[model samples]
Target: VFFFLYIYIYILRTIMANLHELPGAQADSVPSAAKTLVWGPGLEANIVLPARFFYIQAVDSSGRNLTASPGEKTFEVKIVSPVEEFTRIWIQVLDRQDGSFLVRYRMYATYTDLYIHILLKNKHVANSPFILNGPVYHEGCDCPQSSGSVWETHMHCPQSFPQIDRDLALYASVDPERNAQEIPQRFGQRQSLCHYTVKSNKVYVKTFGEHVGFRIFMDSILLSLTRKVQLPDMEFFVNLGDWPLEKRKPTEKIHPIFSWCGSNNTRDIVMPTYDLTESVLETMGRVSLDMMSVQANTGPPWPEKNATAFWRGRDSRQERLELVKLSRAHPNMIDAAFTNFFFFKHDESLYGPLVKHVSFFDFFKYKYQINIDGTVAAYRLPYLLAGDSVVLKQDSSYYEHFYNELRPWEHYIPIRADLGDLLEKIQWARDHDEEVKKIALTGQQFARNHLMGDRVFCYYYKLFQEYAKRQVTEPNIREGMELVEQPSDDLFPCSCHRTRVGDTK
Candidate 1:
């Protein structure tokens, strides 16, 4: 009886230890193994959720870690629907301490590659360029074999899509008519943020030009992504070039564009790089100017008139003459070499009210500061190449100042408003994918000749082993991960382990 009781006690303890990590094991606790804690789509992949969602933190296997907040999405999580081409889903795992992730696999809008994480090894490259070709759900239709609609995934918009709005939409709608071109699409009645039935399953979006309302669904995938992005009325940002009569009239030098509609802005389906060359060509013609560039009462290094400056009118005709002198001296200054001076004379009229309200000081700082600050770690080529500045992360100080440290309503924006940036980014990807590929793929002769997906995986896997424990299970990686081992630490291992490594490798 004693022996039997002892044996039973031992068996019970072992069973308890094993079952301790089960779903209902300890209220609200999800174990490492059972928890499919996907964290990121890397730096470039995030539109709705930033990469910080997958930051790194660790605790004992017991899972005791104090968290700063219950949930804050990072790892650039975005769960999107399968709609257009080049669309994909990104994921990773986190420590759940501060909600930092260990590995992140994000979908690059242009590069159809996967960022896979292997245990006790480095990451492998996954070809994610292919869009969903499987049957998509319409809910409005029947079940599996029903009259459900399927997406062919042909839409491949650029990386940085411009902010879509009524003006822009209307512009695109009428643009084809304006240029007498063929219109390819019928405007869908899709509203942004339109909700759908919630079900827990893998959701993948196809491309940049999915329904406008689709952005609301981005956070639903990364449940931790809760920050709502309210769109800012940017009619003001667009009208910044219209200076009061002091300078030239505001003609759309920097007009909004739709990549789909080629240069003439027609609704012509374009290949990826077509619009990029056009945009770069257009921007090269115009330059960014600011208060620093503005000429003040005191002359700078050179006292000749700068074309652009602030003007104050005087009651005396003599003062008026002096103003004319200033304008004459700086004729090429306030306005460019090409405009009609009549626009400035028309000022205090069309451009005055618009100019008075617009300072741009606030906007410039945020554009430069926030964009620069947030993208510190990712500033490296993987996040962006040099040309695609829109998605290219700025500095983190900007992110800290604008987001973490700044008060509400001051340079404040939501994830939704980011749609503008999102579209623009997608456009950039579409436009500059080749240049980006060159940068990502080019390094040494080895990189040039051998840096395909598998080799890249091996290189990263070697790094992962040196830095962290990553295991490769995707079968694609099994051979690569096995062959490489850290040699410095172990000159030799036991014969059995060596044989095992030999067999596996």
Candidate 2:
């Protein structure tokens, strides 16, 4: 009986010991895998200059570190190819006390490609490449500081500001039967006569041909600034250019609000305004810009596309109407149709062979796509070029932010504003199939590289920085939460673990 009791006690103790080891055994059985790499706090694919310090944290599948020792891990940061000597130095890895690590460096100019690599116990853990856009500042240039009088000068308009009312009244009195070219040109000429130039320091504020609405004008300028710079609220920093003008006209019970239009006031700014600003950027609202390459993913491959040239738009301008006539004359070569009758309800009878509206993506089905300007440069140019179709772009006086950077014929086939050479251009493209395809490829690549939302943001950031320098008084915009409550180290890691390297305070 004594021997049996002793054996029973030993068995019970053995079971308890195994149970104690169960937790450790289960932990060892689970696979420790690093899943994703995340950017630092408030850090995105777009990074502006003077923002040198930020971190990239690597986490396991469970969102926790597999190990918490710097001695047991490896971290490296590298600026990707075409790296200039100016950007080569100062990029270094900080001690990874926990799972989180730091990459600190100052950029002289913009860099689109930057990479980070991490390893745990000699095994590759995480790798990522990101974009950083910096303002181009030249050394030895005596840059003027911002001041008060500059704001007054930029906001001031010509003495003939009241003439806009007269121009509108005269435009209304003009006979609708007048030649299509006569009305727009006559109004444009009158507007040009009414224009005046105001200068504050070296910066000048001049009028464009027509009056773009106050809301659209203000929104576009702010969007370009906010989309790129993570700075103070521009609303707080700067006064609306139109607000002062409106206040000055106290006798007018109601200010004349113009229809949506484009601006030459923003010409020096170099970026063009899009009709879809509200839909695309959600600048004033919460709309997120869709970054996916829609043209490549949704459109049919180049080989399967139709050989005919295609165009579609509302009857907004004389050039567009001419395009419709050309399409009807050469139906086989050109497929053009009215997509909307919103602006020209009375002219419905004039439209012949109009088809139901088709999605913009459908335009990519044809091998050749025609891009013509609406009010200014048609905002669709970028979206059209994104596709695999070769673009026959009508030359216009208007240009967008990146228009200066693009090469004609190399990136797209250029046609005159009159579009008289449309048929000839189409035939040339048809005969040179390989060359047309190459142009399409080139255009697509250019759009992807330069017209991406991140790239656009960078362009605006640089423009605003330069614009701000011209001002006599600094903008009075309110600072954001991130800037106000900047972290103790001046950097915040998304992860809980953090290591301090220097006196960030």
Best by TM-score: 2
Candidate achieving the largest lDDT: 2
Local distance difference test values of all predictions, in order: 0.24, 0.48
Off by over 4 Å in 2: 1-268, 275-293, 296-298, 342-346, 473-505
- Compose the digit string of candidate 2's lDDT tens values, residues 148-186: 233223212122212233223322222212312232343
RMSD after CA superposition, every candidate: 25.9, 19.4
Displacement of the residue 98 alpha carbon in candidate 1, Å: 3.9
lDDT (C-alpha) at residue 268 in model 1: 19
Per-residue accuracy of model 1 over 183-267 as CA lDDT, tens digit each: 1121112211111111121122212224434232222221211111111111100001101011111232122222211222222
Cα-based lDDT at residue 352, candidate 2 = 52
How well does each candidate superpose onto the true structure, as a TM-score?
A: 0.21, 0.49
